[model samples]
Target chain A: MNQILVVDDDRELRTTLVEVLEQEGLQAVMARSADDALERLQQETFDLILLDLVMPGTDGMTAIPLIRRQAPRTRIIVMTAYASVQNAVQSLQQGADDYIVKPFKIDGLMLTVRLNLQKARFCEETEAADLDKIFNGLANGLRRQTLQLLSRQGQMRFMDLVRALEIEDHTKVNFHLKTLREAGFIDQTSDKFYQLTTNGQRAATCLSYICKSLEASAQARPPIVP
Target chain B: MNQILVVDDDRELRTTLVEVLEQEGLQAVMARSADDALERLQQETFDLILLDLVMPGTDGMTAIPLIRRQAPRTRIIVMTAYASVQNAVQSLQQGADDYIVKPFKIDGLMLTVRLNLQKARFCEETEAADLDKIFNGLANGLRRQTLQLLSRQGQMRFMDLVRALEIEDHTKVNFHLKTLREAGFIDQTSDKFYQLTTNGQRAATCLSYICKSLEASAQARPPIVP
Candidate 1:
């Protein structure tokens, strides 16, 4: 179960939030102030923090950097009143990942909590060395294209890739193929066809997202003459 | 020269910012309040707006969506007192692109202004349909790889691309090549060599940035077991 720390001065709100979180199968802990939250941080690790901004003695804003320092990977979500919605944005700039307004509906709060937890898990699972290899593997355009091709075709023979890529330099293609094989993005099947590995498929998905964003950004641009 | 609108109830700060922007060769206009700023926006289009959050009427936060609706492409940079630095982030979330706290150095302010103007120009110059073509041209992995290959090689013959891409089927390569040509990303020389067009080069640069970001994001991911 995911561990969550709720830092709020209001006992009633804190209790309500903790109950809501527990009902959702999360392990929720309460802290009455920023100082209390810091104390808890030293004692245990938390996956996420729901920090109230206006708590007395070491206010939420002041405690953000401190909490971040002590638990660098913990996801902090600031809780602000509706009138201070702008403060939520400020909290984000100060390093909070997301925010919830006071009088928030249970559904919205739970959704935000779940989303951050999912992101936290992804961050935890990703390794620096694995990322380095993934970067080096996809660094070359040919290699990226190879991954994309395999994603689409599922499997392709050496000659098929050669034709699809249209490179006259067979040795150059072979070199890139070897590089990808070493990076674990692709492997030769029993039938001598190239296909994406599980990791390779993940990389391909990331690539697709990148491409779609590129397209979206492009489409989102205002007309040149406008 | 880029047109800039400075909106603030404080006459002294507005005058100073206007002078600074003018010194940097930007055309600066002034508005006394959010209402005044909206009125100016109606009369003339601006490339950028420097807005102050705490005014007598219609605060900056409330004005953001209104200003955005009136001048969708104009970049808004909220100006806040040093104590309300968090409000800057709130401003950003509310639709402002960037922010600067009061008592900021002139150099930093100029830098921010120039950067926003540059971005505004980019948005102004980008057309929706052009982006569509760029997306379509780069949709396929083979097509994107072909662009990358040409980017590295500068120019290549059809057979050269065939060899470099390692594909045995020439027609598939030919089809993609034609598509890229029609999309205005590449062109064939009289000598039968292919090279990226100016737009294609831009697309290549965009692709390079995307790849680097992917690498960076991968590297930035926290360890799964952490």
Candidate 2:
């Protein structure tokens, strides 16, 4: 469920907005001022904060960065009166995602909330998909070995790799090679040789470096007494 | 031509390697020591650096980060002898891209150089392609204005944007919207309304923020009297 925190000093307006947000099928929480909002934020994670600009203490503008620091991914929409729209626009510069003027229709406020949530979801999903491919490619021991061999030898013919790996089954090696190629870690040349692509080389280099460190640390450790 | 820096204290080996690299159509510059390499780096850019691990002063391992800071994109391949391959491997963690042991075949070294250069080219080309699409999308005033409107209003119908933009020619607005949608900046809803996609929203927010800063800066500037 989408979670929202509505922060305003005006008690009646705050309650009405929270009621309307809840009616729209969102989980809405309310705080009376920025200080109360910050305290509430510590207790719960919110997807969005509907912040009122001019509060008696710790105004919305001052709390914007504080809230962002506490929850980097939490989106904020500052609420300003018509006369304070300029200051609210300034809050956007300070990291507020968007703003809404007071006297905003409940429908307009709801639309903004939905759109921001959708945008965050879309970005997270896309990034996760890309990372999934890269991580899956690196997860296999055989694939990492294949990449390491390529990293050391620069490029290798299929038969050369099969012999170098001392693997009797060429088909198993071929399958691993195919997986690496598809994962964008390696590529085949026109002359039928396989070599690490940029991302592949980077991954291979990092893995090799890590292995080196692990071996060094292991060798440096004192052996157990018999 | 590809530029390579061969940094080694051994005059005979450095000369022989530079000759081989140049014969292979690479522009190879010889640096007798790490200090010499750093000086040459300030004068010219290189695609790759062949660094010798042991030198009279300022060895290859110490030069790795310095070279990286000087030319962040330049790939480094540390050269170590058989006994120091372990130390050379540790250099990878220190920022070396890859390492080659001494008494290495000239062919093997050349292949490593070619592969690293090719990987760099592929990465650059791929990133440039993606950036081209984004830059092309943001190049137009009309498209930026459309994004600004969506940023402020959350979502808009085709006619709503046309009316808001006050553009008499509906076809012009249509063309801009198509471009934005194709570039993945915006998407169409099931109800035929237009809204910013995840990337689109982020881009719009950044553009809006930049516009605000620019306007503020302009206002801050003192006007010149004729």
The candidate that wins on lDDT is 1
Q: Write the per-residue lDDT of candidate 1 for residues A15-131, one digit (tens) a residue.
A: 999998898788999999999889887768899999988888999998986776456567888888843534654566455767766778999898778767766666555634455
Listed for every candidate in order, the interface RMSD values in angstroms are 13.1, 21.6
Assess every candidate by TM-score: 0.41, 0.33
Alpha carbon lDDT of each predicted model = 0.74, 0.70
Quality of candidate 1's docking, in CAPRI categories? incorrect
Which regions of candidate 2 fall more than 4 Å away from where they truly are?
Answer: A1-226, B82-89, B127-129, B132-226
lDDT (tens digit, per residue) of candidate 2 on A1-226: 7788989999999899889888877789899999998888666778788999889989889999677645545678888774332354346535676777778888888877876665444434433343345446655666766776776566889999999888999999999888888888899899999998866765554442222221211323343211
In order, what DockQ does each candidate have? Answer: 0.04, 0.02
How many steric clashes between backbone atoms does each model show?
23, 0
